[model samples]
Target: IGASAILAENAAILSSGGGDTIDLGFDLNLESPINPATVTDVSEDAIEGLKVVLAASEEAAAAAEASMPQELVDHLDELSVVALKNATNLITTSDDEVDIPPKPEVVPTIATITAPQQEQQSPQTLNADEVSLAPVAFDVDLSESSVKEKTLDEQTPSVRKILKFAIPAIGVWLCGPILSLIDTSAVGVLSGTVQQAALNPAVAVTDYAALLIAFLYTGTTNMVASAQQTDRGTKDMPRTAKMMIGAMRMSTYVGAGLGAFLFVFARPLLRGIIGNDAIGPAVFAAALKYVRIRALGMPAAAVLGSTQAACLGMQDIKSPLYVLGAAAIINFLGDMLFVGHSNPLIGGTAGAAWATVISQYAALAFFIRWLSDKATKTTNEDQPGVINLSDAILEMTSKSDKKDCNGKNRRQSFRNVMDTFKGKALDAKRKRSTLFQNKGVVQNIRESSFGKAIRRRKETTTKSSTDDDDSFSTRGFLKNRFTTRDLFKLPDAETREKFAPYVLPVTSTQVGRVSGYVAMAHVVASSLGTVSMAAQQVIVSIFYCLCPIADSLSLTAQSFVPAIAEKESSMEKSAAMKKMLVNFLKAGAIFGGAMMAAVCGIPMITGFFTPDQAVKELVNSVVPLLLVFFGVHGFVCGTEGMLLGQKDLGFLGKMYAAFFAAVPYIMLGVKRKALAGCKSAGLSSVWTVFIGYQLARCGLWLGRAAKLQRGTYIAAKEQESAAASATTNMSALLAP
Candidate 1:
């Protein structure tokens, strides 16, 4: 459990790369402070570099520990331990190694220190002159090879790369809107306003369900991305495939159950939501039928969502685009074939719902095919064999070297890994210390502790008693760690615990957002009369059409931020995240600006949706608020993306919960205005409040991103932890 906690704690650092304060487990304010300012043997760069790395990244202290020089890292690592013991009382292990608490889960600024005692006295400050800490964490390697020699361009994600992922992801986000637009245009062009208004409530119900299921896929994406980071370029493909398969199964079951519920309660849900007064009995009847049909697609939507998330986690954006594109084609064609001008037993809207369901099922089939094929691929082609994830876990917690039934893994060489995950240092002088013992391979600090541990398993070789080297190297390691388990099994508790931090916070956010959308459609806009609702639908469709433009940055942040968490240095990780954010924001800004201009300059854009002049005028009236929505929408998404990328889920969840709770009350005002028939109480006013919430959201998330980039949160958390450790007078190592 401690080992798992270490992985979870560092995963964020490995991914976010920046933490504010890194408690080096040292207390500088002991009875007599030893002068750290002047050291005889170590160069100033060595000590300064240590300082830079340890001020550490966390709670809004946007920072990551940079991979550094081996001699210095080793020297300081020993000093850190020495400093640790001299400062605070600690227990010695049987072998005399100090137990370093899993590196303080470096959360960036403003995080509450879960220190058992809040009143614990804070650590006394060390003067900079006394400490000689370096100002810069970057370029601290002090190796003869200077910064100018290393090409940072290769490290940064290029515009082409960002667009490659962002474009497809934007398409993925735009898929629903695009599909709905096809239905709206077809139904409105043929069936008229009454039929078109029916789409308002029905689409709301379906979209909310789709939004609510975000936890399934979003959690999978972050989990897979974290695993990829843990592998640190070892390319553990099987682990990834196994996780995706499990997530897909979970999503499928959840989706199916949600679909069944909706199918069973479709009528009551619609009637209860919009009530009878909103659109007349005809519109309510059509909406109920549409929702029932749409409910059938939830199971399919679930599978596709997870598949898309897995692919995106791997940074394979185009695949999701292709699947969504195919779905769109089916949806467009199905709408034409199934929906018509004249009403049959069920209405035209119901026919469109059926088309949507068919498209969803088609996407599901493609997703299933993709998953099976993806699962079978080799993780490392160069390596002759693969190691399962379960094998990886066993080695981390294993303390004994036991032989399997076949008598493989009896070799003494594979030893360091057993103690490493427990925060034990690699024995540099051991006869077969595979970690950093290759004659001149002194780059110890270049790889994360976890990264080094993972590599030990990757290059493992097993030997048997009878034949010196005949035993299978990879197979031996697997057996030594634990018995082979079914590869298709779900991720165990430890793995899910890692994912919970990333998923739980966002779960509330999604639910609140879903509630807000549902309220907007039913409680807020429903009673505004048929022409008003029809015009609202027209505006809504345009909003969906331009969604790709607004959503591009958010998707880019989601795809790339966590993908590059394994960079050698905290500086590089921080720079990389910032670079991606800057580039993505620029793209979002440019596209969003273009969208606003197009809408304002081209009012005739409404002509495509309807022949009725009344609907066009109403749509035009809301153009001002729509512009604000588009202009601010992109930035909101981009900021949220950045925060989401940082896994600042707790913050986002609160904001979203507040917004969700506010939706009903705020919409009540809109409902009253609509009842009183205020001229401004139409779509424009309703959307104005939404735009305000989005703008507020954008400001808040951006502030968070700034704090994360600065790593203030990280520094504060460490200070709090250090203080608590000192105050509590805890005997055990500081809890991670």
Candidate 2:
């Protein structure tokens, strides 16, 4: 501030000076000479000293100027003028402030800095506050966020979800029959008429047998699935395992019994159905051979069927598909190698039977392996040890832990040696030792990989009272994994009482269903000749192939109905049922439309089954009837499924019995009117009877479903009314 004041006074003095002199002074010394130290005091003496120095310098300058001659003065004046002009030029040329240049319209590349260049150019001397103020650039990763969003979408159920279950189930169910169709076609192409015709009854017998045992499959599936849904929260896995084991053992016995019956009575059954007068001796012989050979596979078939049903109940259709696909391949290859060859190892018809038998066993093996794997994985927590029968016997016979050579407990040297060899080292006190006695040895064993597994198994088997929930001991493991000792053991009193109502209905329903098929087959074999039966088989196979669309939906309904009924409120349950019914009806329409399209191309399709023109024409005549049958059957199937889901088996059983009783009459009527005069009735009459049966079935189911729906609505209304009445009574009592 002091130096600034002095400079200001000096600048004021210079401004008062003459213009030319001011210029000359500026040229001589462009800066102020006053020192900051001298100006610091700002006293009177300092000011006076500054004035005296300035006066002296001015006097000296005047004396020197007077001494100068006129010529010298003129020359100096000229030089000064020139220097001023030159200074003006330099200012104009160098100073942008004096002469401003225009900025370029476009920015230059050199002026544009990238993020990397800006970082490089930025000063590194910034303080913490400065650094924090700096802007940062980063790339945001969106993949993880996007994946989470997609996962949430997948977790929500939609049409896509329904199709996911339906499509796989349809494929799994269709694969077996489709394979059989292929086998039939292959056999037809290779064998004579008798051999080909024999396939009809043979297949029918085997199919009938399979269907008869289907109760185990269907029953197991429903029970297990329902149990799973109920125990979803509590996870009572032991009870579920027992149900499966019991069902499986029961299926095995039933299958074995049926198989033995079929095996022993194969010829008699074939003779009874086809009869000697109706068909050639060769056909009957072939049919008998096929039935007998095929019967051997029935046990395996039963096991496979039961396992398949269990898998379906558990919503695990993929396993069955894999198993079936492998079996189909084996059967196809067997058919190619064994059939159509004279003097083949098993002959033509019998070869096909053997192929079926082998494939069935192979399927059973895969199913067993899958079941074992599933059990091992699921029962990981607190699993029990497998009951060691030998150990149990040993424990029962011996009074002490120690055992002698003669299976007696004795504290002896020889016994001790044997115990040590068995990994049970005795103590110096001559006392019996545990299996894991030596700490060092036990530690060593535990450290090994195999020992770790043993330890795990041991941990699973051993249980404490406090750890009951976690316990899955060997007792349960053995019971579930192996055939029960009492394979034919009846359910416990509690279980029998619980399942009694369901048993009769389920049994009756299954029996009635099989009876209808049996009656249809009997009618076809007895009334319609072999050719018509063969055509019927072909058409029926095609019908089944198409029917799965409806059947799969039905199965889906059966699988889910109980869950829906339990979880939803009355209104919500009603809505769900309506939605299910509408969806199934739509699916039926679609399936029926597809069948109609198939009917249009019956000639080409029937060609695959047979080359005979008469058979082809007969198949075509029945195509329209088949179409009607499928359409009506689809609705029946859907309603049946809903009823089954609702556990309305009693009504279904009664309806099936009524239908079964009327089936003979229906067939007889069709025969009397349509087939009485003709030598071969063709398959048209047969399909007509079937269509009538389906129509009646559809009507009964629809009526029952409507009645159930109406009853439910009425009950809900009554409940609401009662609740309202109770509220009114309470309000009246509280009035002041």
Candidate 3:
């Protein structure tokens, strides 16, 4: 019955033209009760309940009509009347079945939904044409989605781990460039562009010379670190020692030989490559002097390089840092004293060169001493010497016969202690002869204060000897030191043969890099003239100085990856490489951003280095291109480092060779363009070529690293499958 009433009301409301109000009523009684004692009583109660429900519904409808607007009330009343008439007609027409009309299709129209208006004499109505008919849409905020991405980045363990190594490595690597910058700054204060321009090419020559032997440093670090990882407990100390010795010998010989060659040919080489036109005759002369003086320190520099590499390989960076710090201080002092006032002893650029030479030799001496000390400490701990004095004292005090307080026994004990102190053995027959012959002397010795002190000291020494396994801890042991001979002993023929394969690849990689720089210098000098070449060098120097930060990050990867690879599964190694690449790319991007900022400020920076307007303008104009070059170059360096870590020397050598081979063509193009009278074919052209080179290097290295990673993963999976198959076959064979 309630369901029928609700349907009737809904139908009425739908049929109403507009503004119809809905009224719902309930006719539940709290006080009235219907008894179920008899069927007649239940019938009477049901009839009464129906009447009450009908009356209550009518009253609710009347109340609803009174509260509603006149139009809505009229429409509702008409709807109700129509519904009632239809019901009456249907009931009267058929006793068993009733015909009903089909319901109308109702469409809702929410009209005139205008914004609220203020009270006025004339109320405004919105026109249908003026109202919007289309559905409204809202814009979405994309920032909501990025929150999860940022959280994931923050939480990544691999990124954090990569940073742990990268940060420190970058810092250490930065020290070299920073020192170079200081040198440049000191040179910049000189009188003219001649001296300053000369510094650029001179430094380049010295750097190239250093690069020729840089393999010793890199090779030593990689091999030694790897060896240390494989032999963690010093079991392979002898082999490592031999390798160290061989590296030192190679460094010194190559360094000394190169130094002599450079010292002799400095003038001709500068004239041939840099040319008399590029560097003024006066500048060339000064540069020649600088190069010769600098050449004198090459042996020391090489030795220091090898020592540093060894220290780095052992993960003992502190020692190298200390040595370099001291060297830098010495160089600074020498610069101030010799170069500041143009001292008569050493003047101008030569003074600076002399300062560097002095510092290099000083550093070399310190490194040698430090290495020797390290070796001696290790050797001493390995083979501890016996403390004879303490042992003899302990032996004499422990003898039961010597415990007596008699004058003769005391004198004998004193004599035995003195013999031990003097590092001599006493025979029993000799002791008896001395004791009998010196009876009066024995009485005098027993009563002396020195004799009593000796007995007391012997008792303490004996007690200490019994308490400790090695009495040397309490009493000093003889110094069993390792000499330079032991520290730098040559490796056996087989060991050298094993390491020989690695030497060439490493050297070639460095040579390829040096060749690129040399080519760049040649291109710049030929096309742009000496002034432009000088400007190019200054800009290049700045870029190279900052680049090591990125290179350091790469070096970190190189140093860390191999060690990680040795211990981890192939999957982990792949992940490590990926993580390292991501870290390197991030570091490169950050460095690039900084360089871009520096590029923007290049005008100001150029002022500090050079007062010449043309040079400053040239540098500033190419700053943007240089920024791109540095950004891409950082990743190239990092990728190279990663490959280096994998010990992919052959691939690196080939890539470097390809780079060197391609550079000449680029230079040729620049030269042809310049000859064709193109205004744009100058420094910008050079930078374009450089940028292209950087891009090519980055792409090649990144692709190679990816390929290596994929290969490692595939190899790991194949090995795992093979292991599983072997295990299954063994299990089948073992079953009954």
Candidate 4:
């Protein structure tokens, strides 16, 4: 329901009279002319044509299993070809720059003309006049309705709520960066310039290694959000709670696998990334040590990332802030104590790595306990364990009066209550018995997927069937321990098949991005030696720490777009969404402008990172280029956020996959300069290349956003105009 729901009411389509109506009927092909949203001077023939079209559309829509979100995202192109855009004419209209006509008046026709209840029945038996009446334009209540009864306001969040989610998210983004910045500052001042230079390669390997599997975080969130909305809009299976469990289990295994892979091949991976002679011996050794040690925390980091993503998808933002805030403090204190002139074995970069590892595991422990507690509470409420099924049934029968309750009504009510209870339970036994063995694949790929949306019950936890059941609390929960068995259960056959579409493209995209970036950073930073490497590290560190500002805004967009677009609006939903988007864009632009001044101020504090004049000058020289990069990235992140929220992941995946092409070209350029012993290629040109890439992304996303935004605006204007003129056209339309 969070994504998209059924529009409950049918809209009245008032005509201006004349519409450039092409032939519209049961059969319309590419060459057939379609009616535009606005019409004037309509003849009876056009009305007849429209009636046919409206009937066809309504029939298709009612029979369509595709929710509005499913229509917008899962079957966009297919809808265009068949003109099912009218299937959701209640919301937004599709087709390039087109508006939709309102559904016409309903009229009775012959028995033979009446449509059958089958999925794809046609009104072929109707006569000409009956043909027009055959396709009824009015609302037809069907037993298996695809859309939700909720309005746009009900389906999409308001700006205030989005900001509520956004503000807390900024802190969540900052926690990881704060740890890195601390390490950079402590290592630069305490361990000296050599160790600082080593950080560029060390961080590239360690951070990106975690990000390489970041699909688990991003993909899980997208799928969960979609599933949640679907559950709200339809009567289908509830998948959100199921997915929550599956995602945690799947992410842990994947994280552990990645950790093992990195630990075993740390040297070769680092070597391949930086090239054979990318950094000097001492720097390489330090980076390798850091990478190997950080690899140990990969599983915890991955699980934490996935856990946080699941919460975000559920629109719970405060939990991450609470958890990460405590983790950040732990990391800060650990860094201060462990780094700078500590035990020789634990000093410098190694100490920083150790500090981060400890904090990550701490955060992980808290999250696990928190999840287990929720299960314990939910389980206790849903079922009091001391009352066995047979005992409960016997007790219920004993309580019933023989004439009224025990005869029939009591048993029927009991069955009904039992079914609802089983549907809502969270324990392993219920999951094993009920959650698996889903029905066959759906025609809509979106429908085939499994999800787990827990609609939390308000039932009192203190209430239980028997006195013995009250004591069943602590000991009952301990059987599962810190982690729920629900999270350990692997995906069954149906799950693996359906879950692939949601996760595979995202993982592929992350793989291309992480590998390409790690390779590109190695090439660019290593070309100019230790001085350049150190300068690059400082610049990157500054950018990433501030990057959360732009990132949080992007995340806000991602969280809102799909569900809003799927909702019915007179442009209000889209307009509200657009307004929210503009606010964030403005925030990004203002933040970017301020950071330009911040870059200039960086020269004043250059001594904090390194005392070396060469490193300082190189960093200062690139401030102008860095300003361009910061400004360009603001728009880049916002537009990409729009696309991400649009669920255009398939296109995004291919776009980034193509982006890997630029890495090889940039690599060759750096290699040529290094071989020729030319120090002329500076960080300035590197920043320019990155700026160009940012511009390319902004341009692409901007065009796509513009097209989609225009479609929605036109849809809104037409809806308002049609509604406003209803009185004007009502007489003319109903004229005998």
All candidates' lDDT scores? 0.60, 0.59, 0.60, 0.59
Clash count of each predicted structure? 40, 6, 0, 23
Off by over 4 Å in 2: 1-162, 189-193, 234-236, 337-345, 374-503, 514-534, 566-569, 672-682, 723-736
Best by TM-score: 3
lDDT of 2 by residue, 1-736 (tens): 2323324334434443323323323222213342323323445565455556644655565456445543344444545434323222221233322331111011111222244533332222112222111111222233433433333232222333345556677876776576667567668777766677778777777776666665666677777677666544333355556666666666676688889999998876666555336577777778788888888887777767766766666666677778888889888888887777786347678778888888888876666666655343554354322222222222222332465445644323222222232221112112212221354575677689999898787865563222333322222222345542434465455543444566567677766666666666667767676577767777777777877766776666666556554432344345555666666565556655665676667767778777888777777888778768766665777677778877788898797777767876776665665446674554666666677778888888889888877766666567657878999999999998
lDDT of 3: 0.60
Candidate 1 lDDT trough over 10 residues, lowest sum: 119-128
lDDT of 4 by residue, 454-500 (tens): 11222222222322242211111212333545555665666555456
Q: For model 3, how big is the CA root-mean-square deviation?
A: 40.0
Model 4: CA > 4 A from native: 1-150, 153-164, 185-197, 230-239, 278-282, 336-348, 372-486, 492-498, 568-584, 674-680, 710-736
Clashes of 1: 40
Tens digit of per-residue lDDT, candidate 1, span 224-274: 665555544232344655566566666766688789988998877776567
Error of 3 at 725 (Å): 0.8
Q: For model 1, how big is the CA root-mean-square deviation?
A: 19.7
Q: For model 3, what is the error of residue 171's alpha carbon versus the real structure, in angstroms, after optimal superposition?
A: 5.4
Worst 10 residues of 2 by lDDT: 100-109
TM-score of 3: 0.61
